[model samples]
Target: MALGGNPIFNGKSFRGATQAPRVPSYPQSQPGYGQPQYGQQQYGQPQYGEPAWSTQQMSSDQLQQMYKMYNRPSAGPAETGRMTFDDVIVKTAACLAVLLIGAAISLFVAPGTSSLLMVVGALGGFVLAMVNTFKKQPSPALILGYAGLEGLFLGGLTRFLDALYPGVGLQAVIGTLAVFGVTLALFKSGKVRATPKAMRFFMIAMLGYLVFAVINMVMVWTGVVNSPFGLGTSVHIFGIPLGVFIGLLAIGLAAFSLVMDFTSIEQGVLQGAPERYSWTAAFGLTVTLVWLYVEIIRLLAILRGDD
Candidate 1:
């Protein structure tokens, strides 16, 4: 399907999807081949090379049926078992709804318990993400489960951060939405694209980002940095916390990842991907969005902490 840089879609090829069916053609009657000539017919005698029944004239009912069949609209992508934009949208919305429900449940839980669930959510989400990414076909239950876990993680994290920095969660949500809207608009307008060169750069940057994240996590775990954000807050660049720059970079990466997602979905639709693969598309989007939301909220929290 010539998918873009999103790993979820990189190796997928909607194998079993079928194209639209072709219209059936009716055979036309030939004058001399299957029927006797006007003056050559003999009573109770069969003509050579002619069938017992003549097909010289079609009934008015048959003609009308043919006309109706010819004029009937062709099957659409959904009817043909192919993926469509609507499928992606509907499935994505379903995933997000489940995520929101999970978040709401986590948000109302006790703080200490919420933290434990958040940790569980984080670990569980990571495992499911890997599973979904490598699976040959999409599974809705697993995808929705991943989304729900992410919501739990996000809800707990937001609760923790927002308690210390009032309104930060709402601000982060607005920021995430703004970035998403802008990126989508630019993509649709052809102003931004996941070109080959851009994708290469994205991969390189993602690798660096992952390396730094791992290092930061290790430092936090080992007590090498006493700060809540590990080296992000401990280190400063021109009196600005290093995390600020890192956060911006991560958000940018996430935004660009959305472009990759859009590119893959567009290609899938154009190439007649199977309808079931729309779940995969929805899963990819949810993953990117969860990453984006985390980065944005963390950035906001860092800024608020600095203040």
Candidate 2:
């Protein structure tokens, strides 16, 4: 599988799934077996020692019909019910729309209510992300549900942060879109790729980042750090918050992750993966974009806080 970086595509197989079945050919008759002998009956008749064989002569209309059928183009991915770029785009748009709706709902609610929902969204989204990740097949409902929960979390978080730093949410959104667009363009242009070496590095960096995030969360929970972002804001590297560097690295990783997503999606379409798997591709892209958005917003917050 060329999908080493993204766990969502790791175990799925698309080999020969949408290929047309081979047409079987009738065996040609041997010279001695089917040929008329000196004392045998004519064609289409049964001889004394041979079985009867019937030959039907087709009319001109029937011959033309057969010719047309033989010359007709083979079915495409859509006709065969296989995956395509359009399917991925449509499904991804649906997921994003659901997410936006959920976000709008969260933003319009009361602050206290929004905070409560944010917590619920965070926990629920995490659960759904795990479930969707491990599922053998994609479930549209569950994937959309996950997107909705993530939206709630993001909306609440943005509301809280944007209150302190006005326009930061919008900036984050723009930054996320810019990064996504650039990454996609690069991937499409073949200027960037998710090579095996890069993927290995990505895995290592991701693992380290995860560990740091867990430790930071633990510190915040234990009151080990008084800063809102824990070490991210509390520590500085020559007048720059440590988070700025970490955030940049994280954003780069997320961008590269989009490359992997694109690669996997392109390969899936080419390999004729089932149309349902487009939802899986959509889910993966959504997950990456969300992470990118959060990182951008957090980075913006950290920078604004220093000012």
Candidate 3:
């Protein structure tokens, strides 16, 4: 059964999925990062006839306090070093600005010859996406490359859709922005979260959706589904294309995916994750927003095609 939508794989890590940088552990008394205080005895060192600090000597309160002090801080807007939601927003906006520039060029200058650009964009984006995802050390060059490729793809796609429905591209853009805004608002308001059960459901649904999409693509490639939209157009319920329903589900999943992204960033900040992990958080968010836009555009196309 289709569960609630989530990321492509929940338990299995993506090859290039960025992770928060690990914070270096330090001794309890150290004032700064990763240095033992001068003349301090190492943990578990034996003292002459004195009681050794051990698990037995620590009270529950002391242990809890220690954990609290050392525990990572939450990812908040104004958190000290951790990546804030504001950082993610800024990066995402920068990406969209690049995308818009590319779209304008494709729409006005190049006109109908966007297929090549789309193919190039998709391939380039995939390569850069993988590089950024798997990179232990984040490179600004690679990250920007990924953004540029994505812009190309977005530009070509927008131009193609605009040619078909005239105003549909704008509509889709508005819808995408609205969804993103609402999702962010909800996240900030604490109305939604990446709870264990919801996350589990999201994982299950994502796997099933991926399998279905793959199968559908294969069928299309093999000429099994004669329709232009593969199984989406041909398979309909009550005169509604299957793709329509699926797209709606996908949009919902994307929204929830944003929530998860927010949660992850939040956790990272709260945990005092290293600052470099901000790039990772940004990448994750960009991936989700791209997915959301794709779904919105596709849905609009399906709707316009029906009419």
Candidate 4:
């Protein structure tokens, strides 16, 4: 739930580098002396109106060196420079790979479905998620650590649920992928957007969801509700388990969270943010997708319970 409807996106502003001073623009033709455009001037060129004797020229090597020094790619990719799509993709892949490995370990090594490991993973993942989220600068190690911890939690939880529901984990995985693919396609096509108004609504709804989640968790912990899912399964709306609706709401929130992530990454790239911030982009996407998967699996579990 940490990534669910986040008020603060890992998409924070990075001020390490600013766009180069637009490679000083020089007029191609001045009113009096027609000095060629900034880089257009060659080794030996006199102003259009200048006398031949007045011409002062430099060597071709000098001109080329000056041009390169002045106009070469000012943005450094390896040096906290502008981010690219490749940076984001590669970083995200690394995080997901770590997550998968962690999941495999938990799934294969856990003894008779241990909730202890799940709890540990959940707690550790939560802590790391908070750390990485709030940090001003993105930390690759911390983000990857969060991924692994989250994966452990996921693997344990999936095993537990699948044991009861049988094949539900696979179903949930498919569902999560479907939602993600659909959301991404819609975003790339510009069919759906996170507008200002939508964002306002999102904030309000997210606040309400957080309140509900906190209350439910408290109810469960305090034993005010005996049900495993607390209020989510205990309460009903329109003869349907309240959790069904709540899970759907959570899924919607997660989907929008993705939209926000995508929008932020788009802005970051367009604004020429540092490539190092790709870790930031990767982190945001991982958070949202994990939330999405959790919601999907939980919803499926709720449905199976109802049946």
Maximum-lDDT candidate: 1
Q: What would the TM-score be for candidate 2 when compared with the true structure?
A: 0.87
* Clashing residue pair totals per candidate (backbone < 3 A): 0, 0, 11, 0
Regions of candidate 4 where Cα sits further than 4 Å from its true position: 1-11, 14-16, 21-80
Deviation in angstroms for 3 in model 3?
Answer: 21
Q: Write the per-residue lDDT of candidate 2 for residues 1-307, one digit (tens) a residue.
A: 2354698777788886767799999887645875766676676666586645322556778878988999999999899899999999999999999999888878999999999888998999999999998898999999999999999999999999999999999999999999999998998899999988898999999999999999999999999999999999999999899999999989999998899899999989888899989999999999999999999999999999999
Q: What C-alpha lDDT, on a 0 to 100 scale, does residue 49 get in candidate 2? A: 62
Candidate 1 local lDDT, 39-96, one digit each (tens):
7776787777868764457788888898899999999988988899999999999999
Give lDDT: candidate 4, residue 239. Answer: 85
lDDT of 4 by residue, 142-179 (tens): 99999999888888888899989999999998998899
Please tell me which model should have the higher lDDT, number 1 or number 3. 1
The TM-score that candidate 4 achieves is 0.79
Ranking by lDDT: 1, 2, 4, 3
lDDT values of the candidates? 0.91, 0.90, 0.73, 0.82
lDDT of 1: 0.91
Which residue pairs collide, candidate 2? none
